[model samples]
Target: MATTTERVKESLLGVEEDLNMSQPNRSSFMQHAIKDEQTGEEYLNEQGFINAIAPEGEDYHKIKRDQYSILFNVADRNHKGRVTLPDWSVFNNLLAKPDAEYEIAFRLFADPTTGQVDFNTFKEIYARNKTSDTIPFNWDSDWASLYLGGKKHRHSMTYPQFAQMLRGLQGERVRQAFLHFDRNGDGYIDPDDFQRIIQETASHKLSDHLLTNLPTLCNITPGSKISYANVRAFQNVIREMDLVEMILKNAINKSSDGKITRVDFLNEAARVTRFSLFTPMEADILFHFASLDQPSGRLGIADFARVLDASWHSTAGLVDQGVSGPSEKPVVSSKTFLHDILVSVHHFALGSIAGAFGAFMVYPIDLVKTRMQNQRSARVGQLLYKNSWDCATKVVRNEGVRGLYSGVLPQLVGVAPEKAIKLTVNDLVRGKFTDPKTGNIALSAELLAGGAAGGCQVVFTNPLEIVKIRLQVQGEALKAAAREGEQVTKRSALWIVRHLGLVGLYKGAS
Candidate 1:
């Protein structure tokens, strides 16, 4: 007797032949039969693909494994046991472009001829290359001759290979910088060289706190340079130095001789000391906007003070005008004011609830969108994902239908406060303006409210937004960077506060 799969295949074949002979154009019967056959085939294919990539000793497909729960669910399209060639093609096409590496396997398994990728082909290509030590060909040969200098070699690399390349380069660079910084040549950096070169450098002039923290910044020994493994630990230091140079460059460029003076340096130093962080360009923009003497190209302490005073006064005036106009001023009586306050509170609460509801609704899609955005470019047969539907289907297949909601909680938590504050403030502001003739309020109050609400929201939500965006964008690489001491890991809000402070958030505020 034939196996269960063979029986099903014979059954499907019989249906196809019957339909072709009796009803070649039988719309209803043909459609139903085709759909059923396609569905079964899809299911079988999906299972085969999963089994192909599944790790050994696991009864279920590897795609059903823990870490890949999200990825597997996303790739399984058509609720079929398999993802068809058309489905795989959609994934492969996108993977071939920029910023989409997750779909690497689709590209690799894609049958360039019939435009279909079967399980055996996917398995053979994937498993064969995976055991490269036994292969005859060198996997590291350069294959970019078609684009560059006809220097063809076998140029294909896995994630590990690419990572090794970057690590190797970083190691080499760190060795060079370490050697370059080791001035005294006593086999290590001496105290005198450290003070003269590192401490005295313009880049190291950041306040005492940062200077004190410098020793903790890297994992290197006091006298020795950093190792190759610890090279990423200097990223923050390099980033800080870049920012400092950017500020100084702008200041020097302002001078007629294109040179910085002591006073110019002192002024910038004082500003940085006060703010704890500064983006010089943002400061210049703020000054330009607030300058009363438009063409002066210079601002004094008075101009700065006036700008703050004006902002405060204008904000207050807008609020006052919103609450009390010619119509009635809402009777300003204590009882009336209390009633108005209660009403405003209700409005705010209602607005918040609605905002929260809306946020939770779109969160899963947002997660998928974010993942798609974070995807990196990759070659065929090696990608982790295919396309949006593939990603979603794979998630369902691997993670029991809930994998798509992985980061939903954090996203909902981040967006609700920002949205609620914006909406409530806008309603309150619009409530202030009363029409004189028709007792109707204009939309102007809403605009002012939006501005104020937006400012407040930025202060509160920016840190969360920063962390969320970074988490979404960089994935595990950023987290690893933090662990290696390359970045100062802190909560999004506190990190922003410590590094940027109040003025840092409002970097370009006038």
Candidate 2:
């Protein structure tokens, strides 16, 4: 009266109890008890038996049926029991080949009516292709001609060829995409098609500037239709954009978390662009500007998409300007050389201007400090001035404000060349000391270069400092002499130099 499963469960109960008891002889007993009746051979291997059935009461067949149903439903999409071309295409796109080859495989097995395929048949074909070493068709000869077209008629890619060109693409899928976009079927895609593509693919709304410039980016005249070549070029651009996004995502999403923290984003941005197109600082600035809306300190897919879209628009603009081209390096010539020289000269001139301005602004303070330090009183209160502020105020009151800026002109004139020489010499020396093999300067070399720059600038700056100090202290000296009933005359920098000779100009040289 016992069912077959019940009998089996009762028989295995002893073995299960023995296993729980950690019996050493259970394996031997199981081997003897579970032998094939006719052949006297073991019916199940250790691993096979353990994996084949569930715990004592469960039905293995039911579990297997449930698993099969899950896989079938996932592939079937509509729960229609049979898989369609779209269903198979989605499944195939998840595979390694996912291209023209998969299309061929689909065509070979697909049923025309209802676009339905048996799940078993699909699995058989997939398994065969997965194990097969050789493809049935020749890749380089007749197949290329059949799918990719011959040289004379190679204006556009066939469905198979387009699928082959793109990884994880299928012929049916590509046909549907092309048909959806090529509205009039005139064999050309226009700006409207491009706008739709951008909307669907990037989920980004095209700006007015981007819309107006779309024709140029697609390499077509205004109001003209985009050719297959144009679409292919745009495909390359989109691929590059996607690659950049993927790289950023992988770099920032190190923990496999769906979101990236602000700190992680910055560090990864710096690391990835450290030696590439952008410097670390430039990359950080770009990310900051790109991620302004991400207040939660975490970046998700939408944030990354926005950043990538902005970057792609900029790149497209560069392409339109002829600054960048597909697979072509920008040509460098004498114009480029001249441009480099102009940029360097402009930077040097700006540095000189900045140094002159800075010297002018701080000259009054320097005048005060110099006058206070030059005083020779033993007690601080007995000095010519109480402090730097007192000295500045007294100079303005006594010398009608022009006294504090007495030697500023000479200081300004010297600062420009002095700063230029210091910066230029430091750069030149650092360049000279750089290791040819490594292209890096050692710490000691950098320090030595800095010292060399300081030593070089002293030749120009020391005389300026001496003149500035002398000019600043002159007012105080005159006042002191006047208080002592001795007259003193103001002397100009030119007169002082003439009276003291060439050695006097270099008085503070040591």
lDDT of each: 0.43, 0.52
Clashing pairs in 2: none
Best by TM-score: 2
Question: Mind giving the per-residue lDDT tens digits that candidate 1 earns over 1-510?
Answer: 877555433322111221122121122112322234543532224333333233235422211243332333334443434444343333323323343332334334444333334434644664654434321222222322221123343233333343334334333433444456555654454333333233333222232333333343222244344332332333323334444454555565666755444357447655655564533433432343234343355543333332222111111221112211111122233336778778867766776677678877876676667767665434455654678787566556755456555545555676777777776676666656644222345567656777888877777667555555444444334434555678744344345346665655555444
lDDT of 2 by residue, 356-390 (tens): 99998988888888887887553456766778788
Cα misplacement distance, residue 265 of candidate 1 (Å) = 74
Q: Which runs of model 2 end up more than 4 angstroms from their true locations?
A: 1-146, 149-344, 376-381, 432-439
- Considering summed lDDT, which 10 consecutive residues are worst modelled in model 1? 310-319
Candidate 2, run of 10 with poorest lDDT: 13-22
